[model samples]
Target: MSEENLRAAADAVLSRLVGDAGGTARLRVDQWRAVEALVVERRRTLVVQRTGWGKSAVYFVATALLRERGSGPTVIVSPLLALMRNQIDAAERAGIRARTINSANPEEWEAVRLEVASGEVDVLLVSPERLNNPDFRDGVLPELAATTGLLVVDEAHCISDWGHDFRPDYRRLRTMLADLPPGVPVLATTATANARVTADVAEQLGTGGDTPDALVLRGPLERESLSLGVLRLPDAAHRLAWLDGHLNELPGSGIVYTLTVAAAEEVAAFLRQRGHAVAAYTGRTENADREAAEADLLDNRVKALVATSALGMGFDKPDLGFVVHLGSPSSPIAYYQQVGRAGRGVEHADVLLLPGPEDEAIWRYFASLAFPAEEQVRRTLEVLAASDRPLSLPALEPLVELRRSRLETMLKVLDVDGAVRRVRGGWVATGAPWSYDRERYDWVARQREAEQRAMKEYAATAECRMEFLRRQLDDEGAAPCGRCDNCAGPRFTPEVDPAALEAARGELGRPGVEVEPRRMWPTGLPSVGLELKGRIPPGEQAAPGRALGRLSDIGWGNRLRPLLEQGAPDGRVPDDVADAVVAVLADWAKGPGGWASGRPEAPARPVGVVTVASRTRPLLVRSLGERIAAVGRIPLLGTVEYSDDAVDARVPRSNSAQRLRALHGALTVPGTLAEAIAGGGPVLLVDDFTETGWTLAVAARLLRRAGAEAVMPLVLAVRG
Candidate 1:
C-alpha cells in the first residue's frame, strides 16, 4: 500500500474509533508513520510518544487495517488490568471485537480463548504475567503465535530493566517474539522510556538474523495542559493539610498519589473525615473496591482516589482535572508516567508534588528488595539443579532463602535467561550454565541510585519541572514549558489553613496500628528441620498486638523510620516516641478494637514485660521495654538472651525461611525469667521494629513453652 492509502485507512479507523467525533479525528503525521510502519511496511516498531498522544490509535488502527485484510487477531500484551479495560473499551469504539484473559476474568478465559480460536475476536489483551502461565503458555500461546497478525506491546518500557517500571514478567515476551511466524508486524509503545530503555527494548524486539530492524519513533515528551509545581512540605501533616484545603479548588475529580499503601489509606481516610468523597486504592485494596473506586472517579462521583503506584498505567479519565503527589517518586520517568495520568484530555489540569522528607527513606526501602547477590543466585541454581522434579514456588521456599515474591521474580528472570523452565506442575532447572551478570546488575543498581538523585534534583530544581521530566525521558527537544512553577512562578500557595493543618496533624499523629500475629509458619519450614507446620498452637501464639505506627504510614512513619533504620546510630528510645507509645497503649486499652473494649477473646492486661534482645539497637529495645514495664506497673521479668554465637553468625534478614532458620534455637529464656512468668498474666514482648515478625513469633513461642500465660507484642513500628 502507498503512504497515502495507509494514511487514509488510519483516518477512517480513527473516525470509527471516535464515532461522530472521529470525522475530525485525523491521524497526526507520527501516528500515520507508526501505522504505515506496522500495517503497510509490516515492520517491528517502537513508538516512544508522550501520554495522550494517540499511541493507542496507532495500534488500534493498525489492527483494524490488518484484520480488514484477513489477518489474524492483534495480540496486545498490556501491563495493567485498568489498561486492558480501557483498551477493550477503545477497541469496541472502533467497532472491533476485543477480548481479554487476565487474573480477574479466569472463568471467562475459556470462552475468550474459543473466540480467538474461532477468529471472532479482532484484538486480544493479555497481561505480561499471563505469558508465563503454564496452561496459557503451552496450550494457547503457541496457537496465538502461529496465527497472530500483529503483536502490540503496550507499556513496552517494562520490557527493559532500565525502564522505571521494569517488570520481570514482561521479559517473557522475547520468547513469544522469537516464536512468532514470519511477517507478523510488531508494535511496542511506551510513554515513558529514556534513550537507554528505548535502545534496550528495541534490541529485544529485533529478531537477530531473521527479522528486519525495528523503526524507532521517538517523539517529544511534553504535556502542555499540565501546570506542574513542587511544594516541599514540612511534614506529612502539612502535606495532608495542603491537600485537604486545595482539593476542592481543583477543576475536576482527580487522583492523589502516595508512595505507600498506608499513606493512601491514611490520606483517603482523612479526606473522608474532611467530608471529601475519596477512596483508597492500593495493592492491598480488594479488586471489587478498586473497580468501584475507578468507576467512582470516572463518573465524578468521588472527589479523588488516594492511591499508590498500583493506580497507575492505563487508567483513563480524560477530563481528570488534577493530580497531587503526596510524596515524590524515585525517578523522573516514573514521575512523568504518573503525572501524565492527569491533563490528558482537559485543557488544563493541576499537577502538584508535595514531596515529603521521608521520600528517600521509602525509596531506600524499595531498593533493598532489588535483585539478590550473586551468591544467593548461585545457591538458588544449585538447589534447583539438585531437584529431580519440577518444584513449585512453595516447595522451593525452604530450599531457597528468598521470599516467595522475590523467588518468583528470580525464577522469571532465570526463565528468560534460559536457566530454568516453568512447566505444568512447577519450575525445573534447564541445566544451562548461567553466569551471574554482575556488571549488568551493578549498572542497573547504579542507574537506580542515579535516578533517585535525579528525582531529588527534580524536586529542588529551579528549572521548568516539565522540562526536567522531559530531559529525564531523554527528550532532546525538552525545553522550559513556561507553565510550571519554576517557569511561571508558584501556581499554588504554601500557606495552609491553621485549622486544617491542626486537624491533619491530629489525624496523622494519632498512633496505634494493629499487628496481626503470624498464624501459620511459612510453607516448607519442615524441609529445614524446623518441624513447624499448620496453624500455630493457640497457647503458643502471640495475641494480636499493637504498634505505635506502621513504617509505611505517612504520619508516625516519618517520625519512627529514621530511628529504626538499619544503620542509624542506636540509642535510648526518644522521649517523643515513648510518649507516642504510651498513647498507643492508652488507645489499645479503650479503642474500639482494644482488649478492654468488651471483646470476649481479648487477652487480659499484661503482668510482665520481656524485651527481645536487639543486636543492632540494644539500648532502644531495652529502654522501650523498661518504659512499657514502668507504665503498665508490671515487673520487667527478663530479656530473651541471644546466643553470642548466633549474634556473630546472624543471617541477613532476607526472607522468611532464612529468618526462621537464623532465629530457631537462637533465643533462650533464663530459668529465673521463665519461673517469674510461669503463672503471670499476658506478657508484653517489646522490640524496636517488626520486619518479618519472625523474631516476635520465635520469642512468643519460647515464652509460651516456658509457661507464660500469653504473649502480647508491642513494638515501635511494624513493617508493611
Candidate 2:
C-alpha cells in the first residue's frame, strides 16, 4: 500500500473510533506515522508519547487497516485488568472486534480462542502473565505467533528490568518476538520510560531479524493539563485531614493513592466517615468490588478511590480531575506514570504529593524483598534439575526456602533465561547453563537507589515539578512548564479545617487491630525439619488476639514502625505505647468479640500473663508484659525461654517452612511457668511484634500443652 492510502485508511478508522465527538476525528502527524510504519512498511516501531496522545489509537487504527488487507488478528500484550477493559471498549468504538483472555474472564477463554482461530476477532488482549501460562504458552501462543498480524506490547517499559515497574513475566516477550514470522509488524508503547529503558525495549523489539531495526518515536514527556505540587505533611493524620478538607474543592472525581493496602482501606474508611463517597481499591480488593469502584469513579458517583499501586497503569478516565498521594512513591518514573492517570482529557487537573516521614521506611521494607542471594538461586536450580518431571509451585515450595511470590519471580526470570521451562503440570529444568548476572543485578539495585533519591528530590525541588519529573526520564526537551506550584506560586493552600483535623486525629489515634491466629500450618513444614502439617489442634491453638496496629497501617504504623524496626536499640516500652496497649485491652474487653462480652463462643478472661522471651528486644517484650499484668492485676507467669542454640539461631526471612523450622523447638515453657499456668484461665501472651506468627504459635502451643485452658496472643504491631 502507498503512504497516501495508509494515511487515508488510518483517518477513516480514527473517524469511526471517535464516533461524532468532533465529527470524524483525524490522526495527528505522529499517529499517522506510527500507523504507516505498522501497516505500510510492516516494520517494528516503539512509540513513547505522553498520555492521551493517541498511542492506543495508533494500534487500533493499524489493526483496522491490516484486517481490511486480509491480515491476521492483532495480539496485544496488556499489563493490567483495568487497561484491558479500557482497550476492549475502545476497540469496539473503532468497529474492531476485540476479546480478552485474562484471569477475570476465564469462562470466555474458549469462545475467545475459537473466535480468534476462526478469524472472527480483529484483536485479542492478553496479560503478560498469560504468556507464561502452561496451556496458552505451549498450545495457543505458538499458533497465535505464527499468524498474528501486528503484535502490540502496551506499557512496554515493563520489558526492561531497569524500568520503574519491571514485571518478570514480560521478559517472555523476547522469545515471542524472536519467534514471530517475517513481515509481522510489532509495536511497543509506553508513556513513561527513561533513555535506558527505551533503548532496552527497542533492542528487544528488533530481535529475530524480522525487523533488523525499529523506528523509535519519542515525544516530549510533559502533561500541560496537570498543575503539580508537593505538600510535606507532618504525619498521616494531617494528610488525611488535608484531604478531608480539600478533596471536594478539587476539579472533579479523582484518585487518592496510598503506598500500602492497609493505608488505602484506612483512608477510604476515614473519607466515608467524613461523608465522602469513596471506595478502597487495592490488590486485596475483590474483583467485583474493583469493577464497581472503577465504574463509580467513571460515572462520577464517587469523589475518589483510595487506592494502592494496584490502581496504576491502563485505567482510562480521560477527564479524571485530580490525583493526591498520601505518601510519595519511591521512584520519579513511577510517580509520573501514576499522576499521568489524571488530566489526560481535562484541560486542568490537580496533582498533589503529601510526603510523610514514613515513606523511606516503606521503601526500605520493599527493597528487602528484591532478588534473592546467589546461593538461594543456585539451590532452586539444583532442585529443579534433580527432578525428573515438572514440579508444581507447592511441590517446589517444600524443596526451596523462598516464599511463594519471590519463588515465582525467580522462576519467571529462569524461564526467560532458558534455564527452566513452564510445562503442562508445572515447571521443569531445561538443562541450559545459566549464570547469575551479579553485576547486572547490582546495577539494577543501584538504579533503584538512584530512583529513590530522585523521588526525594522531586518532593523537595523548588523548580517546576513537571520539569523535574521529565528530567528524571532523561527527556531532552524537559523545561519549566510555568504552570506548577513553584512557577505559578502556591496554587493550593496548606491550611486545613480544625474540626476535620481533630476528627482525623481521633480516627487515627484510636487504634485496635485484630490479629487472627494462624490455624493451618504452612504446607511442607515437615520437609524443613518441622514435624508439622495441616490444621493446628483446636485445644493447642491460640484464640483470636489483638494488636495496637499493623506495621503497614497508616494510623499507628508511623509510630510503631520505628520502635519495632530491626536494629533499634532495645529498651523499656514507651509510656505512651503502654497506655495505647491498655486502651486496646479496654476496647477488647467491651468489643463484640471480647471475652468479657459474655458470648458463649468467647474465651475466658486471662487469669495470668505469659511473656515470650525475645532474644533481640528482651527489654521491650518483658516490660510490655509486666505492664499488662500489673494493670490487669493478674499473676505474672514466668516467660517461655528460648533454648541456648535457638537464642542465637539465624532464621530465614524467605519462606514459611524455614521460619517454622527455626521456631519448632525454639520456645520451651519453664517448669515454674508451667506450674503457674496450670488449671488457669486463658493466658495473655505478650510479644513486641508479630512477623510470621510462628513465634506466637510455638509459644502458645507450649503454654497449652503446659495446662493453660487457652492462650490469647497480644502484640504491639503485626507486620504485613
Candidate 3:
C-alpha cells in the first residue's frame, strides 16, 4: 500500500472511531483493507468477521472518507430497530450525520428523505423491509440508489435462503444493487455464514452481471472470552429449576433464551417470583415494551432478559456477561450468532445450553412453516394474474387455503422474485415468466435436515463445543478451544435446590390459559359464498373459555403434544391430563367470568356437557367429555354430530375465512341435543383442540340458537 493512502486511512479511523474518547486509534490490518477497498478502490467487499470485530467501524470510517472525497452520502440497509438505534448513536459519536427511516418513526421518513436528497445527511440507515414499500421503492429508493456513494448490507447472511436466518426482505436488496450507478462501492457484512451462504450472497451482489464479485474477507470465529458447555436435563421442570437456583451464580446480567414465547414469559415470571429481576422479550411483545426491556438490560437494572430470536442480530451490548439457552437452536450457525452476544467486551462470560428431549419436536414445529408447495404457489399466481385490479391480502384469503402469516410470507418471496409486485393498495401479478424452483427448494429442505442433525450431534458430542460450531460455519482455522467444558472440565453442575425444584413443579402444575373468543367475522367472507360480515351477533358469540395449556407451552405441552399429535391413535385421555382438566375446571368456577363465579353477573353453573363430535380422535374426545361430565355430575348431552352427508373441510392450517366457510353449515345440532339445551343453564362445549376458533364459534352459535343460555367452550390444547 502507498504511504499516502495508508496515512489517509489511519486518519479516517482516528477521526471517526477515536474522536474525543481520549484514546489512540489504530486500524486492524483487515479493517484497513476493507476500508481501502471501499473508499480508495470503490470495489465491492464482504466482511465475514466475528462479532465485536469492528464491522461497524469499517463502515463508519469508510463513510467518513467517502464523504470527505465529495461522494454522495452512504446508504446502509440495516436489519433491526435495535441495530439502527445503535448505529445512529455511534454515527453521532463519530461526527457523521445519520438519519434513519424505519417502522418505529414513520413520521420522520419524509423529513429524512428530504435531507438525504438535499445532501445534508452524511449517512442514511434503512431497514430491509422498507426497500419494497411501494412509496419508498418507487420514489425515495431510486434517487438514493442513483446518488449513494457507498452501499452497505448489514447481516448479509440473511440475503441467502441457505443462511440460518433467511429473510425475504433481505433479498430485495438485489434490486437496489442493480440500480446503483457504476463504481458505487458496496459492503456486505455478517458474522454467521457458511461457505454456501457466502457464495450465494456474493453471486447476488453481482446481479447486474458487469461488476466483479464482492471480495470476501473471513476471520477466525473463535471467541477467546467464552466458556461453552451443554447440560442435559431430564425435563422442562428440572431445567427451570436449574435456572431458578443458579441464575445469580452466572457472571453478570445477560440473556436467557427460550424456544417459544410462552416459555419466555413463564420463565421471566417465575424468576421474578423467586426474587430475581427479569423481563421477557418476544416478537409478540409491544414495541414500547420491547424497547423498555432492551434498555433495562443495557443498564443492568435486571438480572437477565428472557427472550427468543427477536433479541438477535446487531444488538450492541459490548459488556454482556452471559448467555443461556433453555433449548438448543436448530442450527449451530444460529447458535453461534446468539452466544456471540456474550463475551464481546467482558473478560469472561459463561455460555450454556440446556438441551431437552423436546428440542427436536419444537424444531419440527417451526420448520413445518417452510416454503409453500408448488401447487399453492401456482394457485396464487393464477389468482393474481386473472384479477383485473390489484387484490389485497384479505381478498386473496378466501380464495387461497393458506393461513394469513404463511400467505404473507409466500407473497413477499414472490415479490422479491419478480413474479408479483406490491403496490399501494394490494399485490398484483407482474406478468413475468416464473417457474417453481422445485429442485432448489428441495435442496434447501435437505440442507435444513442436515443442520438439524448437526445440532443434535453438537448437543451429544463430548468434543470442544466452540470448535464444533466454528467447523459448522466452515471456518478453516477451526481448532479445539481449551476453554469449553469438554476441553477442560464441566463448569456447571446439573443439580438444583429442592426448593427451586418444588417451585418449578408448582408453576408447571398450574394450568388454564384463557381462550378469547372471536368477535368480528373475517373480512371478505362474502367472496367465498358466505354472507357473514361485521361483528358476530352478541347472543350467538361464545363466551371466554379455558384451555389446559397451549401446545407450544413448555410445561403441560410436554405431556399433551404426544397425545394430541396428528394421527396419534384414538386412546383415552392420559391420567395426568385428566387431572389437569379437573384442576382447570375447579379454578375456572370461582374465577372471574366463570359460570359459577359468585358475582350476580356470572352465569349459572354449566347445566350439561356437550361434546363436539370429532371425525378424528373421537375416542379421546368422547372419553374426556364423558369423564368431565361424570366428575361434575352433569348430564351427558347428545353429541353435536356432523350429519352423515356434511362436507367437513377441517384443515388444521387455514385462514379464518376458509375455516369459517368450512364450518358454516356443515355441523348441525341434533334434535336430542336441542331438547337437552332447552333445559340448560349454560352449555359446556368441549373439543379436542382449537386452531382458528371458527369451529367453536360455529358450534356455539348452533347451541345459542337451540336456546342455551350461553356456550362456554373448553379444549385440551390451543394452537397459537
Candidate 4:
C-alpha cells in the first residue's frame, strides 16, 4: 500500500472508531494524527506522552483500521501484566474479541495460536519475555505475522538499561520480530523520558539516523498535591513509630518499600500490631499470595501494602496516596519507581524517604552484587559464544552451573555488567567479555561507580531533592522541586555558637579524667607471663602482660589488639629491646584520650581464652581492665583490658568485638563508660558500621537496662 492509501485508511478508521460516532469513543484528535503517522511513516516511531494521553486509543484505532483493510492481527507487547488484563478487559467492554496468553495454561496456547492464524483475533497483548520464546515466535508469531496488521511496544523506556525500570528482555523485541515482513511499522510509547530514554528508544527501534522523526511529548513531572518529606532516624523502632503515626493520616492506599523480606514482613506485622489494615509481599511470597495482595490493593480491600522491589512492576493501582521507604533505596531510579506508584491516577501523592545508615549499606551491597567480576564476565561470554543459539536453563547449566532459580539473577548481573545482551533467541555475548585494558574497564566500571556515587550524593545532597533526582537522570536545566527534603532540612537548624564550643571543651578537660579503651573481653582475655614460658599454654601465647602494658602506654593499644591474635608463645623481643619491655608497655598504655575514643570497636563475641591447663570456656566482655583511679589529666588512650579473673584462667576474645559491645552499651546508657568520666556527663556509644540499626538498638536497650543515664549512638557509616 502507498503512503496516500495508508493515510486514507487511517483517517477512515479514526472516523469509524472515534470521529463523531455516538457515545464515548476511544481516540482523541491528536491520537488520529499519531495513528496516521505511525501507519505511513517508514521508520520506527516513538510517541511520548503523559498518562491518559490516549496512546492506547491511537494504537487500537490504527490497528482496527489496518486489520479491516486486510492487515493481520496487531501484536501489542506490554511489560505490565495488569495493564494487559485491563486492555483485554477494555476490549471486552467494547465487544471486541481479544485473548491473553501467559504462563498459566499450556493446553489453550494452541487454541490461541490457531485463532491468531485464522484471523479470529485482532489484538493480542503479550509480555516481552513471552514474545522472545522460540515456541511462541516459531509456532504462534509466524502464523500471526502473516496477517498481522502492526506491532506496538508499550512502556518502551524499559528497553533502556538507563531507564528506571529497565527490562533486559524488552531489548529482544527488535530481533523477535526480525522475520516479520518489512514496513509493519513499530510504535513505541512511554509516559516520561529524559534525552537518554528518547535516544535509547530510537536506537532500539533501528531509527537512530540523523534527524529521526520521533514524537517526544512531555508534560509536567511535578505533582503539586504531593507533599514530600525525609527523615534521618537513628533506629527502626523510632522509624516504626513515625510510620504508625503518619500512616493513620495518609489517605487512599499507600505502599511501604523495605529492603529485605524480613523487613517487609516485620513492617506488615508491626502495622497489624498497631491496627492498620496491611499486607506484605516479597520475592519469596507464593505467586497466589502475591496475586491476592495485588487484587486487594486494586479492590481497595487493603489500606496499605509493604513490599520489596519485586512487587512494583505489572501493578497499576492509580489512587495511591503515598509511598514510604522503610529504609533507603539503592538508587534514585529505584526510589522514583517506588514512589511513582503513588499519584498515578490521582491529582497528587506524597513520598517519604526515611534513611538512617542501613539504607546506604543496602545500596552498596546491591552495587557489589550487580557488578560482576572480570572472570565472571569472561565465563559468561565464553558460554554464550560457544552456544549455537541463545541458550536457557538446563542447556546452559554446565557452563554457568547456575541453578534454575539463580539463572535469571546471574544473567541480570551479567546484563548490568554490560557483558551480555538479550537477543531474539536467547542471551548473546555483546562484546569481548574480559578486557585487561584499564581504560575499557575503567569506562565500563564508571557506569556503576557513577551510580554508586549518585547514591552517596543523594544522602549528602543539600540541593532541592527533586532537582538532584533529575540531574541523576542526566536531565539538565531542571527546575527546583520545591516540595523535597532539601527544601525542608533548613527549616530547623539553629546558628552555631563558637563560644559555646570553647566553654564546652574547657569544662570537659578535667583532671583525673581519662578516656580508656573500652575493654572488649574483660573477663576472658588470654594472658601470658614469664611463668608460663615453657608450657606453651593451651592457646598460642608469647606476648606478656608487660609487653601489652608497654604497647598500651605508648599509644599503641589499638594496634596491639589485632597483633595479639598472632601472638606466639616464644618470648621474642626486638634485639634492641633486651630490657625495654617495661618502658614499651608503659608508653603504649599512654595513648591519646581523644584519638582512642574515635577508634571503632567491634562487637564482643564468644571466644576461648587460652590458659596453661586448657582453653577457657566461651565468654563475652569488653577489654579486660583493672579498676584504675581517676588519675591525672593525661587521658587513657585505647581501652585497657582488665578483669577480676587471673590472666592464667580466663579465655581471650577479640578486642574489636568487645569494643563494639561497649560502644553499644555506652550509647544505650550514657555516663557509664570511661568517656563519660572524662566528659563529666552522659556517655556516647560509637561504631564503625551501622546498616539496619538493630545492633544499635540492642546496645541501647542493654545500656538503659544496666542503669546508664543516657546512651548516644554514633557510627562512621550509615545506609539509607
**Candidate 3 lDDT, tens digit per residue, 37-148?**
9987888999999999989999998898888788999999999988998888899888889999999999999899889989999989999989989999999898998899
Worst 10 residues of 4 by lDDT: 618-627
Provide TM-scores for the models.
Answer: 0.97, 0.98, 0.98, 0.59
lDDT (Cα) of model 1: 0.89
For each candidate, how many residue pairs have backbone atoms clashing (under 3 Å)? Answer: 0, 0, 0, 63
Residue 113 accuracy (lDDT) in model 3: 85
For TM-score, candidate 1 versus 4, the one ahead is 1
What is the lDDT of every predicted structure here?
Answer: 0.89, 0.90, 0.90, 0.54
lDDT (Cα, 0-100) at 579 in candidate 4:
24
Checking candidate 3 for backbone clashes, the offending pairs are none
Best of the two (3, 4) by lDDT: 3
lDDT of 4 by residue, 196-235 (tens): 6778786767633343445544444444545566666545
Question: For residue 54, what is the lDDT in candidate 4?
Answer: 54
Q: Candidate 3 at residue 36, lDDT?
A: 85
Instruction: Enumerate residue pairs that collide in model 2.
Output: none
lDDT of 1 by residue, 332-437 (tens): 8998999999988889998998989888899988888888898888888888898888888888877776888888898899999999899987998899989999
lDDT of 2: 0.90
